[model samples]
Target: MLVISGAVQAGLAGIPGQSAELGISLTVMGSALAAAGWLLTVGWRFTRKLPKPASDIPQVEQGIRITPNIIRVVVIGAVLIVLASALFIPQVGFPDAFPILGMLVGFLWSVAAGLACTGRVMKTGRVMKNSADLYARWLSRR
Candidate 1:
């Protein structure tokens, strides 16, 4: 809606002496529309019930497992991609030195995500083993 209103505002900009008022009105309307959209989305989310926890998955071990080394490699590869993108933003590009800021930011975030997944994997493995023990005990009771 904001984009549509912005285009309409631009089309109307040619009118003599109405540009200032038009700009002000469009800004207010655009801001209000954005706020209402945000409110609706958040309100809708609030109405939904939370699902079961991760442990509710039956026999997690039977599901596919991600090797830790692959996660590390993918993170490094993504950071490299970010560096390449930042260096070649122009159409006729003169490749510049690596962007330290962008690379550093990407590396930090990717590492954080990788570490989080690693921890989760370790915990899930422990939980899977423990759940098997419970299954064994349940079988013995029958």
Candidate 2:
């Protein structure tokens, strides 16, 4: 970050307009790459592929039924998502990205809640047949 910022600053000089924007863009991308490389080199767990547990495969391979708890979570998540969307409406306009962020949080909460409750994954109107992934996630959380 420091190196890219320093190099970009020195290169920018009195050079105005487009070049400066380009330099800024380059600096941002370079910094991102540098950070990623550093993480990879320093044993970042997420940098490698996750190992699949053999025992975790069966539930995913076999479909599961949704439960009443999952339905409740789905409705709640939907309501939260709708309310989050409302915040972005012009009439209710707020000057922040909180609404956008909330929508994501609501969606993730719905999915996770549904999984934890019934071992099911829900999209807008559809339920995924797999429960192995959910079971594995639940196991990891424990």
Index of the highest-lDDT prediction: 1
Assess candidate 2 and give its TM-score to the true structure: 0.23
Q: After superposition, how far is residue 15 of candidate 2 from its true place, in Å?
A: 31
TM-score of each: 0.32, 0.23
**lDDT of candidate 1?**
0.52
lDDT of 2 by residue, 1-142 (tens): 3334434443543233223444456457767887888877786555555554345343543424445455566667767775866665565343233333333444455455546544434232132334456657867886
Q: Please provide, for model 1 over 1-142, each residue's C-alpha lDDT reduced to its tens digit, 9 standing for 90 to 100.
A: 3434444444444433234444446557767887888898996667655332346444444332444555566667767776677666663332221232333444445565755676577656665546656766666786
lDDT of candidate 2 at residue 133, scale 0 to 100: 69
Model 2 per-residue lDDT at 15: 39
